[model samples]
Target: MPANHRYSARTAFLLLACTVLASCGGMGGSSINPVNWVTPYKIDVIQGNFVSKEQVEQLKAGMTRDQVKATLGTPLMASLFHADRWDYVFTLKRQGVEPQSYKYTVFFKNDQLERFEGDAMPSETEFIAKLGKRRKLGDVPVLEATEAQLKAAEKPKSATASAAVPASVPAGAPPASYPPLESAKQ
Candidate 1:
């Protein structure tokens, strides 16, 4: 190629690259950028022990470590350095709602719980309400069959068929006798 032609080609390539880079840099902080309008889906993140108010209420001044564990579940953090202290930490991160975190610490003396303190835990029902999404529910349809529907479903049985079957067992009634689960050996 001619020297002038080669120089023009290099300049054109550099200009194109600069234009592309400049456009991208402008989008970095622009509100009109696609990234600003459309966000990738983020899953809820829940971690560590979740102790409810009811469980905390069960704790007493001299409860054993085993009892405390049974009532409030295992602690999230228990270090050898803090052998007598049990720490329960819970965190929840949801997309639209604000993040939630709670920490509770239990101090023990002579292998028994001496005292406990931390953030006030929500009740089970309150926590469940917080987790549910806000939406309007439609009216529920009636599920039970009417008397006319039940009568229409019933069919008259022939006398011979009725005789063949001794009697109809009532609904939910246990069988007169249950056959042995295993076959008898000859």
Candidate 2:
């Protein structure tokens, strides 16, 4: 036989052997495709957020557990030992981002927030109430001053520093609005 024919025959035999081995190994039923798995999949996890101190401060220490529940919705991880202790635990993990988003824990002692162990606790609640949704990075105010702002602010303090003007009151702004109102007829 020609050398080329022998080479072709060997290739054919190798392919046939592979096909037989594949069938025995359940290749037809298997869904593991190497080409499909080659590319790395980007896993994105958008975790929900929490409330802030101001929003939760309205919740008093003596307030019933129900009231707290009503105000803050529900705790994420309740104590298995006692129902009274409520733990609002938040844990987030991103692949290449910061090691973590700050863990916010609101521990309620006898249904009232006992100790604010984390800075993230207060902001989460207030953020939710203010935005009518959980807080995101955009919701959280950024304090990192831009280069221009830093330069402007860094300028020597003017002897006549600009007065810290109060916010502008809009038209029809009330002097002091309260719940109780005197009848105009009276």
Candidate 3:
């Protein structure tokens, strides 16, 4: 064989080997990469509920199982062997953002909340900020209504309900009056 032919064959074999290797890297659903410049889009890897500080604060010793469940939704794990223990776990992984994980366990005594142990939880506001959602807090006054004001608030301001609410008033402002839907049939 000519030297040129042998060299060309060797070069072609190397190219094929490199291409095969490059494609094989991700064959097993693996994420390993040798050279990855462009950021490969990775969907946010959210696994569990993002338990907020408020939820943790709501937990208190002596709270009933029902109350605890109400405060912090259903637990992630409830072992049959450990019937009195409940576990709450949350994890988040977003592109460009640091990963976060939380593990909380609540122990029950006689079906009542005994105590809870876990990492420090963040408040809802803080969690939202961590998720990169920044928004200006509404500059709204918190009024301490008098007895008369409270009474008046119960009455619907307008005879007809209006969706166009004033910026000052929060949405879902209760109607002024709520007559019985169906009066007791005499």
Candidate 4:
């Protein structure tokens, strides 16, 4: 074959192969590209009671175990073997965000809170903010009906006004005042 003709045939084959590969990129199924769609939904797992800083700060060295329970709610782990120790653990696992775990221990000596230890606690507002709460930008609208409007709405409407009988109503039965049915003479 002539050199020029051979080069042309090779170019045509290469062009066809390039077009086929380019079409694959637009396919809906898994493409040759490395990119993947991010998951739209992820469950937020919360295993234990969330303890705030204020609740922890309320604890005093002499407070009774019952008071501690009331202030911090029930402990996540209260073992039978360790009667004096109460452990409160909080864990949150959210998608695309780092998991968080907090541990607090309370020791009771004669049913009184002897001491408590844990990491630095977050306040109610701080914790809420950290959980990705959107702050209100402006005053919220208060929607309420006036007395007259409420009374009008509360008034019973006539059956004829609806003009549509419910399907539950039986087809039988004419009024007692209606004339009695009699057979006509043939």
Candidate 5:
């Protein structure tokens, strides 16, 4: 309410604003943020049971192993290396895509019977219960390298200077000239 008190408060507020602004100005130019965390619990659940809409109707649990496989087809990867667990990973991705997968892992107790699991990962019984019918399989996928990628894959050679940076004439520079006397007289 007093004049000196009001002036002091305004001065303190301005100093605080300047300090905050100065601290923040450098952050916009940098590539990395100082604070980040990547705990497994906080990670995205890209993995899950993702059956095509048709498979939605017929999938039911307690179906025999053969019946489940017939409905879902073979697991994406099975281990002769380990054997018991089967991984049926299906992704909903577009062309030229790197879609995240829904990893439905089935751990068979005997390596033949289903066991416990991580979430989004379905029980084999659940997957079977979920599969209404067989969905048609599509072509296997591949990524073609870009031109820069192919060039980078090639062995590096410093001798190919022209290939790396072709010489550029200055924007308004005149073309180089030969002697006019000889060319013109002849």
Candidate 6:
């Protein structure tokens, strides 16, 4: 190839590469990017302690820390600096749905639960319902066979067979016994 043609080709390739890279760089934060339109699958992220309303309701003013822990698994955040305070935090992040976060704080005095407060905790059923996706079901088809179809499916018995014998063993045959798995000692 001529020197000029080779130089031109090199320049064109360099320009193409730069353009492609620039386009990709621009797409990182742009809403119009192809990736933005078709999002990659993101698994549901569930984090921290999930304290239900029932569990919180079980908490009493004089209940011990162990009792509180028993009712509501374990505290997600327990700081050494704040020995008397235990924080229970729950966060759920799922694609195509708003993220959910709930925080509950328990204060203890003399190793006994003094008071507890935080965001209104959801019932177990309510939390479960939020996690599940409800899809509209299509009309179901009839599953049971019609009487005519059942009659058509019946097989005619063979003339030579007096009775249907069990597939594994004959009706009158005794059950076969197996030897002991271990050998008898001398």
For all predicted structures, in order, the TM-scores are 0.58, 0.36, 0.52, 0.57, 0.29, 0.58
The CA root-mean-square deviation of candidate 5, after full C-alpha superposition on the true structure, stands at: 18.6
**82-178: candidate 3 lDDT, tens digit per residue:** 9999989999888776788999899999988887999998888888777865334677786789888899789766735554665567787887789
How does candidate 4 fare on TM-score? Answer: 0.57
**Local distance difference test, each candidate:** 0.90, 0.58, 0.83, 0.84, 0.57, 0.88
Residue 2 in model 3: lDDT: 100
- Give per-residue lDDT, candidate 4, residue 78: 96
- Give the number of colliding residue pairs in candidate 2: 11
Give the winner by lDDT: 1 or 5: 1
> Which of the numbered candidates is closest to the native, going by highest lDDT?
1
Which residue segments of model 6 deviate by more than 4 Å?
1-37, 133-186
lDDT-based ranking = 1, 6, 4, 3, 2, 5
21-133 per-residue lDDT for model 5 (tens digits): 67766677544423222223332234433544344334454555565567656778787986766677765443333454565555555324454233354555655554423
Off by over 4 Å in 5: 1-64, 95-98, 116-186
Model 2 misplaced regions, further than 4 Å: 1-39, 46-49, 101-119, 122-186
Please give the range of 10 consecutive residues that has the lowest summed lDDT in model 3.
29-38
lDDT of 5: 0.57
- What is the per-residue lDDT of model 4 for residues 1-186, given as tens digits with 9 covering 90 to 100? 999999999999999988887876777667454334544677889998889999987999999888998999999999999999999999998877789899989999999889999978899899889786433468767688889889988969788855665546545655448664987667
